[model samples]
Target: MAELLRNYVAGKWIAGNGEGTLLTDPVTGEALARVSSDGLDLRAAFDYTRTSGGAALRGFTYAARAAQLSEVAKLLQAQRDDYYAISLANSGTTKNDSAVDIDGGIFTLSYYAKLGATLGDVHALRDGTPANLSRDQSFTSQHVLTPTRGLALFINAFNFPSWGLWEKAAPALLSGVPVIVKPATATAWLAQRMVADVVNAGILPAGALSVICGSSAGLLDQIETFDVVSFTGSAKTAAKLRAHPAFVARGARLNVEADSLNSAVLAADAEPGTAAFDLFIKEVVREMTVKSGQKCTAIRRAFVPKDHLGAAADALVARLSAVSVGNPRNESVRMGSLVSREQYDAVRAGIASLREEARLAFDGSQVRLVDADPAVAACIAPHLFVIDDASHAVRVHDVEVFGPVATLCGYEVATGNSRLEEAQAVELARRGQGSLVASVYSNDDTRLARIALELADTHGRVHAISPSVAQSHTGHGNVMPMSLHGGPGRAGGGEELGGLRALNFYHRRAAIQGPAASIDALTESTGKVEI
Candidate 1:
C-alpha cells in the first residue's frame, strides 16, 4: 500500500477518517500516495493559528521575520534534489520544469528576505505623508499599514505546488501573518513534504505554517472578517469563492489568479526573415512547450500579420515538430504529461472545440513517445491551430486548453499601415476579456511603445521583445517576483507579487486622526503593536 499523506494542522500530524483519494503518476499510472482531510478539526486549526500563531509572528519585527524566511530558503535549497524527484513523480515534469517550480520558490523567498531587510525594525509602515486636519495644523491624519490579525489561507493549483506555496507565504510571513496552505490534491506530495521539512526544522513558530492536502470542504467556514484567502485555479472556481458566505457576508479578503488566455503578437513591419519575426516564433514555442504549456501566463493565442500567416504557421509547426514528448524520466524527452488524466481529456476536448473555427496547422497526435505507452500514459504532443479570420473565432478567444496547445491567429491589415495593424492586434487581444500578460515583438520603438501602453489596462505585464533585448529578456510565460502577476476581469481582477506591493494584500491600512504630537509618536515608535 502506498503511504497515506498526513495533514499538518494545529501543531500535529493527523490522518483522515477513511479511505482517501489515491494520487497516481500521470506518465506511468503508478499509485504514489493517498490524501484526505475528512475528519480534521478545521475550526480549531483556524482559531489556534489566528490567535497563537498570529500573535507569535506579529511579535517579531519585519527584519526578524525576514531572517526566518532566509533560513527557510536555505533549508529548502539544501534538500531541493529530493523535491525534484518528488515533482517528477507527482507532477510529470521534466528536470527543467521541476527547476522552475523548486528553484523559483527558493528564489522568491530569498528575494523577499533581502527586500524585507530594508524595512528595518518597523512593524507598522507609514502609508503616506501626514495631512493637516485642522486650520491651526494642531491635528493631522496619518495613514499607516499593519498586519491583519488573522491567517492567510492559500488554495493553489496543481501545476506549481512548490512555487505557488512559497510565493504567497513569503510575503504573508514577512508581513507577520501565519499561512495555511491547501495545495491541489492531484499533486500535493511536494507541498506536504516542504511543510514537513520546515515544521521539523523549527524555523517558524508552531502553527505558523500548515498544509491540508485533501478536500477543501470546511476550510472557508472558519474564516473571519480579518482573514485572507488567495486562490489560483480555474475562473469557474474563482466565481464560487467570491460568492461564498465567508466573503459575501463576513467580509473576508480574497485574491484570485484565474484562467488567462495570454497572447503574443508579431509586428507588421517584421517579415519572415527579420530578427523580430524569428524572436516571436521562438517565444511562442517556448511558452507552449514549457511545463507542457500549463502555465496560466502561457501564450494561447499567437497573432501575426495576415499577409504572413502561412509563413508563421510553417515556422511554428517546424519548431514544434522537433519537440519530444513522453515521460520526464527519459532524458531525450523535451516535454512530459499533464498533471493527470482528467487534465489530458480536458485539453483534448478544448482542442476539438477550437477546431470548429480554426484549421489544424500541425497534428501531433501521432508523434512517437520516447519511453512511455501512448494508450496508458497521459503524454500529449504539442498542437498548433491557425485561425485565418480571428474576428469570427469565439472559442479560440474564450477557451483555454491548459496544455501544450496554441492557436495561430492572423490580424487583418486592410489599410497597409503598421499603426493600424498594431491597433487591430490589441483589439483582438482584448477580446479575451482580460489576460495576465501579452508580448509584442517589434524592432520599431514607436510601434512597440504604442501597443504596450494600450495593452496595459488589460494585462498585468507587457513583455516587449526586440533584437536589442532578445538575449537578456525573460520568457513571456515566466512570472518574475519583481513584477505584478495578476490581471483584471476574466484573469480574476487581483494583484500579487510586485516586490513590496504583495505585502499590501496581507496588511490592513488605516488612517489615524489625532493631535499632531500623538500622530508623530505613533510613527516614531519602533515597538510591536499587540492586536
Candidate 2:
C-alpha cells in the first residue's frame, strides 16, 4: 500500500502528478510513504489567497476567529493517534517528545484563541463624569488590530513539522490573515498529513490555508508590502533569503529562527550526587539525543568549572550511551535516527571540524546500533567535544553541529579583580557563541539575578535553574506563546511569540488624530467617508 499525500488549497483536497518523493522510517530505513509537489499551482494558490480566502478570513472579527481556532484545536486533539503514527517515521522520538511538538501545537492554538477574545477591544466609546474641559465631555481610545493585506509565507525546518507549522500559522489566523506553509522536503509528509486533516475538517475558508511540499518556487520573490516571511533553518540560508530582492525592497516582516550554538552553564557550587549535577547531566543528554539532536534550540555547548569539566563530560556520555536506539515502536528504544542520510552527513562533518579547538571527550562513532537497512538509514550516535581554547573562533562558536553532538568548555576563576578573573568570566560569556538560549545552574540568588540581567541584554532568554524552582515541562526546545523565541546575531534576530506580538507582525500600527468621533468612526470602518 502506498501513502497518499494531498495538498490543501482554497479549502479543497488537490492531488498532483509529480513523481513520488520517498519517505523513510528513521530507525529501520523502510519506506513509510511517498510525497510529491509537482503540478502544484503555486501562482494560482497565491492568487486564491489574495482574492478569495483573504477576504473571508478578514470578514470575521478577532473574537469570531478565536472561536474557530478553539474548534480546530478540539478536532486535532481527537486525531492525535494518527499524527503520532506518522510522526514516528521522521524521527523515532518517544511519545512524550511527539506530544510536545504535536499536542503542544494544539495547546498553542488554544492559548492564542483565548488571547484574541480577551485582549482586544469590544466597543467604540462611553461617557464619563470626570473630563478635562466639560462635565458632559467623554474621552475614549480603542486598540483595533487589523490583518495585513498580504499573505504570511512560512519556511519551516524538518524537525518538528506540526509545531513549526502551527506556531507560525496560529498567530496569522488569529490576526485575520491567510497562511502559505512550505515544509522541508525530508519530513514534509508529516505536515502534509496534518494539513489534510485540517482541510477535511472544512473550518478554514477557501484560500485561507495552502501548502507547498517542494521548492519555494520563486515565492520569496513575490512577497509584497505588509507581508510576513518566516524561516527556520541555517544562518547561511537565512542570509540568502534575507538578501532576496523582494525582502530587501519591501522589508516584508521577515522572521528567521536559525540554528545556533546554544549552551548550558553549570556553577561551581553544583557538584556530583546533588540535584544540580543530576539536572545538568539530564539536560545535556536530553538535548543531545532528542530528535537525534536536530532541534534549533538544542544545547551545543556545556560550560562548567575547570575542576568539574571532566566529571560532567563523562557523566553526560554515560547517560547518553544508555539511551536505547532503534525503531520507536519498540518500548525499550529511547533514542532514534536522524531524519535522513544527508542530515546525518552534515552533522558528522560539523563534529569532524571540532578537532581545531576541542577534543572528543566521548566518541559516539564507537556506539553500536541495529539498522535493518544500512543503505537508507542515516543513523549516527551522539558525539562529545571538550573545548580547550575558549577564544578559538571556529569550533568554539562559528560552527554548529546540528546533530546528536555537543562540546564541553571549562573555565577557571580566581578571587578578586585580577586579569585572570576577567579572563575566566569573559571566557564563559564568550563560550555562549551566539546562542538562542543560555541556561545557568546556580542557587545563589544574587549571582543568578545578575547573570539573568547580563545575559538578557546579550542572549534572547536566560534560564536560571535552581532546585527551589524549576519545571520539568520547560526545556530549551520549547517556545512559549508569551516570550520571543529567536536570539540575537547568529540565532537570527527574529521572533515568534504566538501571542499579540506575533499577531502584530501581520499588521501595521498607525495613529490618526482629529475630532474624537471622526477618529473613532474612521478606525472602525473605512466605508464611512468624511465627505
Candidate 3:
C-alpha cells in the first residue's frame, strides 16, 4: 500500500474524513498512493484562509511577499525528487515534460521575485504635477498597484498538476494575497506532495496558503468584491461559474484559462515538396502526443488549404501512427496514458461526434499496450479525425476532446476565401467563441504576412510558424509568466498572466484624477513629481 497524501492548510498537514482515494501508476496500474482529506473541513479551511492566512499574507509588503516566493522556489527545487515520485502515478510525462511543469513553475516565481524587487518600494509616493493656479500640475498623478483585500481561489486541471497550482499561486502570493488551491482529484496527490514540502520548509507564512482535496462547495458564495477566482479546466464549467450571481453582482474578478479549439494553419504557398510541409506534419504529431494531447494549447485544429487535404491528413496520420505508447518510465514509450478513464471516454466521445462532419484519417485505437492491467492504466492511443464541414455542428466547433485526439479542418484559401474564414471563425469564437490561441502559416511572404495580421486581430496571440520553430516549447502549456492567457468568446473571457498582471487580476484597478496638487498630495509623491 502506498502512503496516503493529506492536505496542507493553515501551515500544517491535516487528514480529512472522506475515505482515501487510490492513485495508481499509469503504466503498471500498481497502487502508488492513496490521497484523502478524511479530517479536512472545507469550511474551516476557508475560515483559516479568510481570517488568519489572508491577514498574515497581506501584512507583508509586495517585496516581502516576493522574497517569500523566492525562498519557496529554492525550497521546491530541493524537493523536486519528491514531486517527481508522486508525479509518476499519473503517466504522460517524460523527464523533459516534468522538468518544464515543475521547474518551470518555480522559475515563474523567480521571474516575479525579480519583477517585484525591481518595480518599486511601497508608499515612498509617486509624483504628480501641481494644480490650481500654479499650485498643481496638469494631469499629474501618482499610481501605485495595491493588493486587493480578498482571497485567491485556484481550481486546477489534472494534467500538469504541479504547474497548474504553482503558476497561479506564485503571482498571487507575490502580490500579497492568500491562496486556496483545489487540485483536480486525479493528480491531487502530486500537488499535495509539492505543497507539503513548501509548507514544511516554512517559507510561507502560517496563513499564506491553504489546500482542499475535494469539492469546492459553498466557497464561491463567500467571495468578496476584491477576491479572485482563477480556474483552469473545461469551458463548460467556466461558463457556469462565470454566470454565478455573486461574480456578476458583486464584481468579483474571475479569470479562467479554459481549453479552447486552438489551431495551426499551413501556409497556402507551401507546396508539397517544401520544408514547410514537413514542418506542418511534425507540429501536428508533437501536439497530439505531448502529454498524450492533454494540453489547452495543444493544436486541436489543423487548417490547411483544401487542395492539400489528402497529403496533410495522410502525413499527419503516418507520423501519429509511429508514436509508441506505454509507461512513461519506459525509455521507449513516446506517449503515455490520459490522466484517467473519464478523460479517455470524453476524448473518445468527442471523436465519435466529429464523424458527423468528418472522417477518421488514421486510428490508433487498436494500438498495442504494455500495461499488465490495461483498463486500470487508463491509457488510450491517439486518435485523429479529418473534418470536411458541410454543416458545422456546434458540438464539433465548441466541445473539446481533451486527450490525444484532434481534427484537421480543410479550408479553401484564395486570397479572398482566407479573409472570409478568419472573419467567420473570430465572429463564431466570440459569441460562442472559444480558443486559447491560434497560429497561421503561409510560405508566400505577402500571403503569410496577410494571414498572420488577419489572425492576430481575432486570436489572443497568433504564431506564424515556419520550418524553424516547429519543435519549440517556447509558449507550450500555461501562458508565459509575462503574457495574457485567455480567449475572448466561448473560450471564457477570463485572464491569467504570471506576474504583476496576474496579481492585478486578484485585485481591482481604479483610475483617480484630480487637481495636481491634491492628486500629488493624495498620491503622496516624495520625489519631484513627474506629472
Candidate whose TM-score is highest: 1
- lDDT tens readout by residue for model 1, 221-282: 99999999999999999999999999999999999999999999888887899999999999
Candidate 2, 1-531: lDDT as tens digits: 557466666555666566567777776767776666677766777777777877888887677778888887888889999888878767566676688779878888888888767643422111111122323334433334446888888999988898898888888887778998988877888788777777778788877888877656677766877778889998889999988877778777898888677878776667777777777788888898887788888888887877777788789878877876655666776677788887877877887788766788778777666543445567777888887546444556778888888888877755676523324533556555556787777655565665566566557777777776656537655678777777888788877873567766776553343345654565444321110
Ranking by TM-score: 1, 2, 3
After superposition, the stretches of candidate 1 with alpha carbons farther than 4 Å from their true spots are 414-420, 526-531
CA deviation > 4 Å runs, candidate 3 = 37-43, 123-143, 371-373, 389-395, 415-432, 444-446, 468-478, 512-518, 521-531
The clash count for each model shown is 0, 1, 20
Rank the candidate models, highest lDDT first: 1, 2, 3
Per-residue error at 411 for model 1, in Å?
A: 0.6
Q: Candidate 3 on 106-161: residue-level lDDT in tens?
A: 78878878776654444222333333444434664344445677788888988878
In order of appearance, the predictions have TM-scores of 0.98, 0.90, 0.88
RMSD per candidate (Å) reads: 2.1, 4.6, 3.6
- Who is ahead in lDDT, 2 or 3? 2
